[model samples]
Target chain A: MADPGPDDALFVNEVRGGDQKAFEAFYRRHEAVVYRTALALVRDEMTAEEVVTDTFLRAHAARERLDPARSPVPWLQRIAVNLSLNHLRRRRLGIEALPEVAAWPDEAATVPEAAAERRETTAALARGIERLPAQMRAVVVLRFVHDASLAEIAETLECPVGTVKSRLHNALRLLRDDLRRDFETAQPGTQPLAAPDLGEMGESIG
Target chain B: MTGWPDLARFILGRRAGGDPADECAIHRPRLAELVDERALGGTQADDAATTAALDHLWACAECQHEIADLLLVVAGLQRLGGTVNRLEPPPGGWRRLSRRLAAPRPRGALRLRVAGLVVVPILAALLVAPALVRDLGTSAAGAVDAATRDAATVAVPVAVTHAAALQRAFDIGDGAQADPAAQAVEVVPRGPLPDGIEPDGSAFLPGVAVPPMPAVIPQ
Candidate 1:
């Protein structure tokens, strides 16, 4: 909640100077966001944790190349995203495997009700997001979770703004349709409906 | 009046601004009136041109509905964003990074230790091998010398036995004179026999006729 102070800046500067304390501070500051982003992409917590750790380790190794004047958050995010994507690619090739979770909602239920709701919502969103094609899911996660701007997303994805826009449009439409269908299904007495057809939406966009 | 869909597109495009002349010239003021009813509330001024375009929105319905739909979409998106939790880094994230950065680098010491482990023994082996070999060689030579001396001691008695057999075949006793009747005799004349000895006389016979000594001693 507090604004990052001179100490934070000093710490980052020290990290650039190869200071371990500063590097640890940076890791502690960004691990959750990195892990969450990785988890969203890889769909595995252990892999996500590895991605988070690797991201920080790389940042530490490359600190000398880092521009101290810029905030390290986005840079760190980029590293985590790339790592997560690489992990996915390797998984697809069968060189790596996804991790299994022992429990989920039950474990989350032990938290306070509000926290539980948030967790459930996050889990649902994550499932919906996973159903999307890879490129589209990446755009959605980067845009929504990281709150990255269109330009930032484009830069991260290494694509044009037009591509990012189209991906976002398609992804959001799919997500909306999926959420709607899921909502109807969960409600008792409501008949389960077919997934909303996005062909009309796509035609409208064009 | 402009058609509903075209009017709607024009209104949405105009509201977003960056509309070229071709796009803008077709806008009908009445369409704007229709669209305003739906999308007018959160039409924040996007740019100066967009603000100026609002004058058209004030009068067109089709344009109003179009803008309203766009606004609704935006609002929905914002709600969706709100529903999602704001992602924060894990606790102690930065602290962990700082600890890592502050920790001493171990690679240098490890490399040195490994090098010492690998190289020191090799150097010791190289320095110590020659001495070890020399010591081994000296021990081997001493053993050979001892064996040779033992062999010589053993051979002396065997050689005496062989000499005794040769003496018996010649029928020569330890203290015997040469036979007087032998055809040839070899006298080394090792310092004239004992005092007062004749050429043919034995120690027991002062005047004995031994065979005539050969003119030249047989070899």
Candidate 2:
């Protein structure tokens, strides 16, 4: 794991001392992560923006309580995750498509369009991820996007480690099936999709 | 698969190389659980049930298919993770936050200033109270002295008036220096006196004129 960023603890102390400059500096450093994480979960530009704003606001409100010895990123990410989840709950935007596959580019291109195809694959993957259940989507986002550990995700979601693993396992299966269907239908020449494998599972799967 | 970006490894944070778990009726309900354990290879790879499950799954085409599909899904998710553009705040978001921060904090210097505004006057009063009390004491003493002189001036006039009224009632002539004996003798009662009455006693009526004494006394 990367050593906790020095700025997180330092800026936390400065913000606790009522230093706005320090807080602004801190926000500038981490806002992209926070915002991207929210966008990954919510998939709505507006709500994701709200989540980002609320995350920072809450962080500032609780600045004094922050442990300056640790990285504040996880804490901030946790807040963003919670806010995004709550927003989803309030809107009652239940999972869109889980077992059901989302529509993908169903072309029959024979040529290998690497860059354009990758972008298309990435976009379809995002849409597929957004269709997952909120809780499952959170795990996927945290694990893949934020690179959080299982323990960190469990803490953030307030669930057991076993539950996190199960969710991530299920989430990976769902996205994999959806994206594969999209690829197979889109182009006959598309290759087996690759992914970040933290385990020996990747090579075996391929 | 080789040329394709290993998206699953990127998403799962590990390269897939372990044997896939075969389908178990008992583990079928908990396949994801079993698969997750296998996927998180490490000390977990040594677990008995996970090991047994994987050994069996390597021969199971259906379960292998599921694992392969899940890997692709994880890869898609990994790519999805990076798809989002870095977010900038809404227009003027930082400026708004700066404005809020610039406002005086409830518990900050503004609070101290307000406290000072209230306490400074009270402290000044406390500091000056003794001096004010001393000055008031001095002024009060002077006021008492002036009031005493005014009282004496009014009392002297009142006394002179009372003496004049007494002289008129007694028929004492002006410029006559009446002695106490003469004043006492002038008060003799002429009418029939009560049994125990005596002349020149304090019982005599002051304003009543006395008849001259008869040449012969009548019993």
Q: What DockQ does each listed candidate score?
A: 0.08, 0.17
lDDT (tens digit, per residue) of candidate 1 on B1-219? 269987777778768963554343444332232222221222233444444455555454544444443333333333333333243334544555446656776556645655565467556654554443233212342232333323322332322222322332244345443232321222333334233333343433436656755543321
TM-score of model 1 (CA atoms): 0.45
lDDT of 2 by residue, B1-219 (tens): 243454454434323433233124433444456455443432343455555556555666566665655655555454454344323445655665566556655445544554565467656655554443333212342222333323332332322223322433343235434333322212122443333333333324446766655443211
Model 2, residue B172: C-alpha shift (Å): 94
* Candidate 1 CAPRI grade: incorrect
Off by over 4 Å in 2: A1-3, A93-124, A176-206, B1-60, B85-93, B100-219
Going through the candidates in order, what is chain B's TM-score?
0.23, 0.28
